[model samples]
Target: MSTAIAATSEIRFVLDHVAQIGHLAQSERFAAASDDVIEAIIEGAATFATEVWAPLNHAGDTVGAKWTEQGVVLPDRYPEAYRAYVEGGWGTIGVPEEHGGQGLPFTLQTAVLELLGTANPGFALCPTLTVGAIEALVHHGTPEQQAKFLPQLATGAWTGTMNLTEPQAGSDVGALRAQAVPRGDGTWSIKGTKIFISFGDHDLADNIVHLVLARTPDAPAGTRGISLFLVPKFRLDKEGHLGAFNDVKVVSIEHKLGLHASPTCVLSFGDNDDCVGELIGPEHGGMRAMFTMMNNARLNVGLQGVQIGEAATRKAVTYALERVQSARSGATDRKPVRIADHPDVRRMLMRMAAQTQAARALVYYAAAQVDRTTLGDAAARERLEILTPLAKAHATDLGNEIASIGVQVHGGMGYVEETGAAQYFRDARITPIYEGTNGIQAADLVGRKLGMGNGSAFASLIADMRETSQTAALTELIDVCDETGRRLAGADADDRLAASYPFLTMLSVAVCGWLMEAQGRAASDDDLWQAKKATTAFYLNQIVPEALGLAAAARASSAELYAVDPALLLA
Candidate 1:
């Protein structure tokens, strides 16, 4: 079968089942948009991703981007593709209609973003950052700020960047030394160097708006003292047009392992006196404002995992079908068979499909939950927050595995640069690292999500899983779900409440399996349902066993990792 047909079949089956579970609407964010509109939006995104974006994948990896005195320059095709993105109304998918956006639900936007990331992640970074900036302005900026900036950002006239990282302040915001001094004219002057700022300086948009995090004098220690500011590349004139040079300068861009199309820049703000910035929210409430964007960004990052895995899996299938190899045992004919006929190859493909599908289920469910929280009853919002970290951490980790498996299935060809599988592998390497590392995500799961409201969130999750299991037709499936749910529910406070990193992988597999079973039953196509069933079987039979070991380790020690020192790990 053709790859498109196969993808359509699989996706149709998955969505058909997923739709049966409940209203899988994108989010309350798009409560105003009709179902037809939403469907159109999704179809458009899929076409663009598979056609427009997919073709550029190798080009981006091969040619990458170049930096010069003017700014970061992308491939020639990038401008036209980006223009298509904006002209198609993609840049404003989820923003409010009042701000020149389509005002779709965040869930639908999540899907669209996934497609964009999958098609060409390097190209997607600029828009992603822009959307986050628009969100921040909408939530916290003064009315003038929103009215002035949101429209341009929505229209793709301006792009956005977040300057939160420094050489020393990557994971720990407390270590930030960037400064925002009061100018007494209401605007502040920001001075600091930001590293690894994606799209920090790019020529794709007319102007770049940076949402910078900096410390003010007399502010308290650590993250609490930080403030957020809007620093633009050029000052705006009375007519609200771009004018005059801003002090922000792109010192250099990183030569990274992957994502060559997107420039990760080292930006120096206020190196000259011209860098004027407007404060966002309260002076000391920058972290809070940043969170408003980070929450959405984190979920978006989770979807990237799903997108990358989906792309890699699709590529693997194409390679497996096209390449003929040795026959399986007992084949009487001398003709070679497709490598897919081999048990190991079949096993690998099955594993990749299952993991990708499971990760999709988890993240999509999270997306639906996020949307429901906005438009549905109060309980859903609480549920979504609880599951958000799970989606981000679990999906990304699975993405890493899927990418690795994709390379493995390609064998030696996957390791070489020519196969294009290596690009997916290299691109996927960063998803788990950004939007908070998987380690941080797990810690969030254990430290915050599990114990919130005296275990009410996780308690609700367990109860819901049990309810689903009770209704399940297959006793074995129900037994697996029930047992895992019970273990989750009955654990002591320490077990439930301790550090979440080590235990996150196990928790994810069980929950993912539970969700997949729900998805399988809800499916409409027999073949798709069968596939879902097989995937669930794999999860239960193979993946869930790892949970027991993880749980055991999690319960055993807080410092077991230290038992083997750095010296021993060196080999």
Candidate 2:
């Protein structure tokens, strides 16, 4: 059989496997969310994303949001689409009960985001930031702050923006200089300029609540001095109504390479000395507070990678099935069969399918980790903390690769806007750049995740690998896992991180490989399972070794990057 047919057949096998896992079933939050409501929500989200959002995706990138002296102006359709989102109650998914949210698990939230991002990445930014803001307040905000903000944010009455990056401090949060001065009346006056704030200024909602990071007068230098504060565009009265303009203004907006419909803004706080803000958490702990939201944002970004990958993969698969090219050896007629029947095309599509599925599985597992930590019974929380960064970084990196391959499969069509593959590629590019950057995530893995409990966390990771590999159902996966685990033993932090990373990558591949097989074995149709089994073998034999190489590198010291000089990086 041709690779295209084999790959599609493989994808069907993978979905069948996923469905049996009961991912779409009503979660523990069902009672609070309402009976049959979760299914309705999923069905509605899937339809809206596929129908409404997908159509505007190309247009959003082409037209983008306009930046002017007045403010940022998005493409015409965003407002209506956002309204539909609110009408569907999507904005309230995964929120707390007291705040009018449905309070669903991260799994449900993951499903929603996957569909939404696949539909439109630019559009997804609005709620992504809103949820991030809601999380910060709910977790670290004072009760008054939570009472004031969560309900509106939960209901999508207003949207939220995360203000972290500044011109001098893109990746380094310690370099931040935004200042917050305490006012005797319990509020603070915040003065800062935040650049690259997503959904910074939008007409999608009544107000934009900014979670700002700033320093205080008596604070220590560096990250230790920074604190998080809430700055709303319009001041809220004691009764929670819109009061007056709070000195927060959009200085300008950025014109970017992708995600045009999502307004990226440069925000100036306290330009007129009237920016009133409320503190979140404690003094000199802004980074700690922000980490919660940042972590969530990273996972969401990873999902975007999957979303774009799936979109591009679906498009490529369609084209491969319908577009007839040059006839090959097996062709009896002068005319070519679908390119999907071509060996090379099948290879490309299979590669795309495998990588995309791996990304999805890794990210979803991470979502499960997070849910276990957040809502799972107490025992699972600690392990979830250790696994979170791996999920976020690996999934996103895979997302970018998957989207890139998606374009390649489309051949020349992927490059052109008309084919829409390029949009997926363009949008997927941002995943590794934002949400704390993939490099930073790796560093976190080394510095914090592995180092936690004096390397006990890493030890636990090894134990998990051992247990996973011991499963007879996952023999191929276990072999990959065992090999990777053996390679990662006795490495320093940086090397361990590097090794662990690719090891994690390999682990994801092996896990998905096994998942595909296990799912294929139970498949109702023999032909589909045969195809799936082939792809599974291909992934294990071919791709799992790349992860092994990373493990080999991880077994090495940081001498590679460190031994090189700053000038040597130059061509």
Candidate 3:
């Protein structure tokens, strides 16, 4: 089966059984997202992703995007494929109706994006960043700003980039030195170097709207003084037509391990003092505005995990079923058989399928909560706040793990670049690093999200998991998660920080386990869902028990960690 086709089958099952998307349709805001409409959308997007996008993945990876003085040039058919994506209205699927979009639920968008990302992640990154830009502009941009940029971004006529990282400052937003000075004509003069800007320069769109984080003159130090600016590559005239260059230059692009088609550019603004920008949020409110984009982005990035995992798993399964090897143990004839006949090979394939499906369930569940909160569900908002970090950190960690497993299942051929298994591994490597590294995600979970709503958010999560859990091991995992969370609250800073990762994994596995059981129980006796049921059993039975060990690691002494001096760890 086509990878996108298989993914659609899995996602459809999740929507029907686990994601609670039907409940979302009950809301008047999402009432138009009828069952038939959603099904059509998924089927159409699958076709588009596989036909228009999938064929380009290998070429995009091999030829990649080339950096030119004028702009970044994508591989063959990249522009036409992107144009087809926009014309198909894929970008407008989840945008609000007021912004010239179709106004579907974001969960649907997430599902569709997963398909596209699976087909060709390097190309899909362009539209993904555009979605985040539309989100930021919708929430934080002024009425004038919205009227000016939202239409273009919502429709993908103009792509967008988030420019926050500088060479000197990585994760510490407080230390950024980029500056935006008021030009006394309603526009600001933005001057600074932003490194690692995805799609910073590309020929895919008419313009690139950069959401830049910078300091304004006379503003306070650190993040308090920071502000967000909407700087475009090309300026518009009085008639709102494309005009001058605006001095937004792509100084250089990175030579990365993967995602070669996605231009990770080092951009220079105001090189000749001609870059004009408009403030996004209030003065010194860059972090707030950026977080509005990022919180949404974190969940979207979570889908990347599903994307790569699904792609890798599908490829690995196909190879396993086709490649012939020695017969199973104790076979009388010892005839050659498909590697899939081996018990250990089957075990690896099962784990990959189960974990990928589980991650999909968890992220889609979070996406459904986002839809609910849009319709004024207060509790859903609290749940979304907690689910964001879990989805971002956990699903991405699985992406890496599953991709690595995909390689191992391929055995020797996996090591060769031609087999393409290695590319997924290289691409999956960045998901956990970017969009707030998994480490930061873990810290957010322990320090902020766990305590949200006066601890009610996490408590409510555990309570809900118990309500849905179908197996004892899952219940036990949830219980351990609860215990670990409580202990960390009373522990020292070092211990709490040290325990963050394991607690994150434990909680993530519990959430996935609970959702898996729910899916399993609700599945039909049909061929497709029968496999879901089997995978769910594997998750609840075998994988869920791994959390028991992780729980102990969660309580490991910070003293043992600090026992090694920082100096010894340095290169």
Candidate 4:
């Protein structure tokens, strides 16, 4: 099996048919993204991801990144990869023309990044975080700030990192203790210790911009007190020239199960009380400003699931075709055939392929809504709020599931690291945990998102789903989704929280089923779209039924959950 699978045709199908990215091109903001241009961009990205990025995956995991006294050192080839990515203008996709980018639709940017990640997820983190940072600054930064930093970041000459987590605060951002004090010279002194910072301190870029969340003197307590700051690894002068050390240091990097080349670092700022940072937004609106970046990362994180699913499913399918094991049960000759010929193997493979494709559909659809929202579509913004969590939670969850099934399909070879099937599993384990726990995503969905527009946004979503749910299986699943949404709305907090995960699965599967059915109807019968049609059918026939079982769990009370004593449960 090849190290990478771009899924180019599949992605373009979603962008063109399901996501309907051509609508973006109709708008002046994305006029440059003509079909021919988009196709060429995707083709070029596929080649870069395949030729430049894919080969780095195994070594990124095996040799990994190192934390030396000098800084974080990547394996020798990693620098060449980063430089190629920068010079190719890969990072500037979707950024405005004025910001020194290609000025394409965000839909295209997402499609291209998905290809890169599908090629090399471990090494892809650097560019991914940088993309998120660019978005944050664009939305919240002052004109001066954008003037100084946006161009370099847009070009990927300098990378970026989000510094929100600390030893004391992981999911609970309110408990953070990072501090920033006015230096009386316009700049502020930021001092904090950040943990679990991805691509935190790397030698790959010329300079790293650390977006830190900290508090100031006499601010209100809890989340309300927090402020967002831009602290660079090296101080920048008026002309954006690199200067002094700025006292930011990478104290250590975590040794992890996977993604070794993407350093998760323990960073200390203002160790000598000289770190200078400029505020990005309002004084006490750190959470609000950070959400700009977090939301971008969340969608991209979900795409990580799509990326891994594509890679894992391709690997599994490749191995199944080659690894001949058993004779056909009904065969008279008793000749050994490829495992792909076996009924059970076919079942697993179809499930993997269908679920993976369903996830890609959801991600692209959500990405399209993002493009529409930018064009002042109110409905799109509301739908995007609801779709973001589903995309992040469900896709990443499927990434883990599909990657595990990839291992299962490989049987004995899947367990051994030498065959490299296990690496996909190990790498996928972090997606659901890192962005925000999928459980948290579920809670947010039920707690706040469902309540948007007094339930009108969700109702609108259901109406859209009903339009595409022509098949009985999809029709039934979407109806369950509507009924379940109403049921959860009226349920008590405990019941809602208890059923959150199951409810998330129920609704997410319903949405995916709708998309697949819709895509299947419009897909051409050529060899290129055969996989799409087959997977769409498999998902509706086999996977859509899972929604029924999930609905029952979603409707179940929170009683049994609270029945067990918390301490005793752990003990």
User: Residue 562 lDDT in model 1?
Assistant: 51
For model 4, how many clashes?
0
The global Cα lDDT (0 to 1) of model 1 is 0.76
Candidate 1, residue 388: lDDT: 77
Q: Give the Cα error of residue 432 in candidate 3, in Å.
A: 0.6
Predicted structure 3, TM vs. truth: 0.98
Give candidate 1's TM-score. 0.91
Model 1 error, position 178 (Å): 0.9
Best by lDDT: 4
Give me the displacement of residue 399 in model 1, in angstroms.
1.3
lDDT of 2 by residue, 1-571 (tens): 1111112233223332543224433455434444255456566777778667777776788888877766677787777887888888887888878777877766667777777877788888888888888888888998888888898898787898888889999888889889899899989999989999998887778888999999999788878899998899999987999999898888887867788878888898998988999889998889999988987887788777777777777778888888888887666777867888889889888887767766776666666666656644453555556556666677677767877887887788778888777777777777777887777776666566655666665566556555544334345445655554554454566666666555556555555554444543465555545645565556656666555555455455667768878897895
- In terms of lDDT, the poorest run of 10 residues in model 1 is 1-10
Evaluated at residue 164, the lDDT of candidate 2 is: 85
Clashing pairs in 2: 3-346, 499-554
Listed per model in order, the count of residue pairs whose N, CA or C atoms clash below 3 Å is: 3, 2, 0, 0
Computed on alpha carbons, the lDDT of every model, listed in order, comes to 0.76, 0.72, 0.89, 0.90
Worst 10 residues of 4 by lDDT: 1-10
* lDDT for each residue of candidate 1 in 1-571, tens digit (9 for 90 to 100): 3222125344444443542222544334555556566567667887877777767777788888888998888877777777778788888877888888877666667667777887787787778788789889988999999888999899787899888989987899879999988899999988999998988887777899999999999889999999999999999997899999888999999998888888899999888766899999998999999987887777777777887788888888889888888867787886788878878888888888888888877777776665565566577777777777878888888788888998988889989989888887888888888878888887677666666677777778766766665222233433443344345445654554453565676666666777777766665566646776787777666765655566455555435555787898889
Stretches of candidate 2 above 4 Å error? Answer: 1-36, 468-504, 507-538, 562-571
Pick by lDDT: 2 or 3, better one? 3
Q: Give residue 230's lDDT in candidate 4 (0 to 100).
A: 94
Which is better, 2 or 3, measured by TM-score?
Answer: 3
Measured against the true structure, the TM-scores of the candidates, in listed sequence, are: 0.91, 0.89, 0.98, 0.98
